[model samples]
Target: MSPFCRKVRLSLAEKRIECELVEVRYWERDPDFLRRNPAGKVPVLKMDGKLMAESSAICEWIEETCPEPALMPATPDARVEVRRLVQWFDDKFHSEVTSNLLYERVNKKLMKSGYPESRNIKAGAQKIKFHLDYMSWLLDHRRWLAGNTMTLADFAAAAHLSALDYISDVDWNRSENVRDWYAKIKSRPAFRSILADVVPGFPPPAHYADLDF
Candidate 1:
């Protein structure tokens, strides 16, 4: 599963917007899928008679249109922080961790690209500890990642972490703060569908959907 897609899904769910879920094998370069997103990347959202690509842009459009139960903060500084963290996860974290671990282990097999690379997996496994510890330190200061209130930053981080958790890549015992923060976000109604997601040939661990976990 693509964390970018999941981030958009979580944003829509949080906004209480109803949308149909569609699976697109972008790697195949199907004409129909390509028409929707020329970039050949995931997280394309079609709404209001328009095709929108990119998770950050889609989420921002959603927030601009809905404007209820705000995901971004009111102040400009706080909003900048949220955007910064969102980029941190979607860009830096994705490259260092998700691409190495999830894409290497699961996506390659799903796409029939190639066998999993042990070196990338090992690098991902090592890098995640640093990220988790950084998250713990952030939690030690603020109630949520980026600030006191739950924002898109939290969803962005959760999107990546939840996908990794689906494959049991996350070590919940690494930090109590991070674990408790994840548990809180994982138990939300917005996370129900994500928790129920089932990837063929890759069954999630029992703790995957356990709210108590």
Candidate 2:
């Protein structure tokens, strides 16, 4: 239903965990959906006779269950930094960028909610530059957001950025470092499924699926 779901999806793909993609219009408030997630979220993961909700928690379970190609750092401090950045993207970025842009341009139509507010769209578009600038600043100093190696923080950031990129909202030319970083992640095997996604009434730009882009 949101970038949060994509965060979980990317985690599962990164770990090579074969799972079914269930499309849920959770905003409809279906009773069965509520049973899976009392909050009626679309990212509920049911596997191994267990039902999981909340994107962050589900990601943690995936990490502990499938440690191969670990997404967390070895040292406690590094891991803390990774988690901190994950929250930065998931909470702060979501509120500032994704909610304003993706929700306005995409999710509203999907939910039959209403016409997108121009002010919100403008706000999202304006706010994304700051977030992208912040990403550029981080990449200028390190190979990855949290450290040298990519971590859950990368996936969390990618989850939101990729969704925005799908709408052609990301200005990749703004920063070479950020563009290079995104190119690397966008080419990963884990990103293949996400790149292929298409929403009704909203077609992606050609560069959205172009690996060379």
Candidate 3:
């Protein structure tokens, strides 16, 4: 239903975990979905008869359920770093980028509103450069965001970034390291389904599905 869901889907795929995708039209206020998750979020995961809401919780559940191809570091400090990065991407990046850009440009039209707000668009456009530069700095210092291993943090970050990228809000040329990291993740088997996603009137940029881009 949203990019957060797609991020979980990608992580599950990367781990080779089998699960079913049930799209919930959250705004519709379906009684059953609301009962399952009072928050009415799109990514309510049902696995082994247990329900889980919230993207971070769902991701942690997946990591625990399927630990093989681990997405979290073993060391305590490293794990903390991973969690910190995940929070940065899901929270800070979301506030600065996703909410301002994707919501304005795509979500507004999807919800049948007027045009994108110029102020919000401009702010989002300006803020993304700082985030990209931050990503570039991290990539320059470490093999991955949290460490050498690709962790849940990567997926969380990618989820938001990919969503914005789909709407052509991301300027890939801002940072080569970030661009390369995205290319590596984009080329993964887990990313295929996300790349293929069609958002009605919001057709993706040609390079959205192109791994080389």
Candidate 4:
């Protein structure tokens, strides 16, 4: 529920959607959690007493429900672009960076498992360069990752990037455009709660929460 949950939370905040934060230990396989989401994932949104799962689906639901300060663009083409980038971050970037760095370095220890797999960690570390480069390429050509307006794509990318930044895996120096883009997003009021998150046994880097950084 770490990166995924954080993504949903940030989206909700950005859209001014409010909900009670419920911490679900998915690994524990609690019955209550299973009932809410058979997938046993974090960030199961309970809105109007209706349960919702999957980060992307939940985000879309939020967007449809609360349209103010829209996370998706108004035009069809622009909306598609936003969705595309959202998938890129949640699926590709999450698998490459988040699962490797955050889950290996932190989650395993929290789960009372053995040390992290060096191979996975190495692969993730290596793969991140390619993703960061892709982001730089996108930012270089557009005002935002998806388009001129801030959209769900920004939140999706920021969610994964913030998690990596927490573990000190992101090389912001490699891409000034990406760095500047993140700095703008980080300065938003919606990002305040996420910047303050402190995962147990894992301390964020000094600049992780710094808006000026």
Residue pair clashes in candidate 4? none
Instruction: Please write out the lDDT profile of model 1 over residues 16-101, one tens digit for every residue.
Output: 88889998888999988888888999989989899999999999999999988899999999999999999999999999999999
Best model number under lDDT: 1
Weakest lDDT window of 10 consecutive positions for candidate 2: 1-10
lDDT of 4 by residue, 1-213 (tens): 387888899988987777678666789898988888898888788888788999999999988888888888898988989989999988888888889988898889988878999999999999999999999999889999998888989998999889888889889999999999999999998998888888777778899999878
Cα-based lDDT at residue 202, candidate 4? 79
Among all candidates shown, the one with the greatest TM-score: 1
Q: Return model 3's CA RMSD, one decimal.
A: 1.3
**Per-model TM-score versus the true fold:** 0.99, 0.98, 0.95, 0.96
lDDT of 3 by residue, 121-213 (tens): 999999999999998999999878888889888888888888988988889998899999999888888888888888888878898888878
CA lDDT, every model vs. true structure? 0.94, 0.90, 0.85, 0.88
Where is model 1 more than 4 Å wrong at Cα?
A: none
Residue pairs clashing, model 2 = none
**Residue 51: error of model 1 in Å?**
0.8
Instruction: Pick the winner on TM-score between candidates 1 and 2.
Output: 1
Give the range of the ten consecutive residues with the poorest summed lDDT in model 3.
18-27
Error of 4 at 185 (Å): 0.4
lDDT score for candidate 3 against the true structure: 0.85
Q: Residue-wise lDDT of candidate 2 within 103-191, one digit each (tens)? A: 98888888899988999889889988998899899998999999999999999999999999989989999999999999999999999
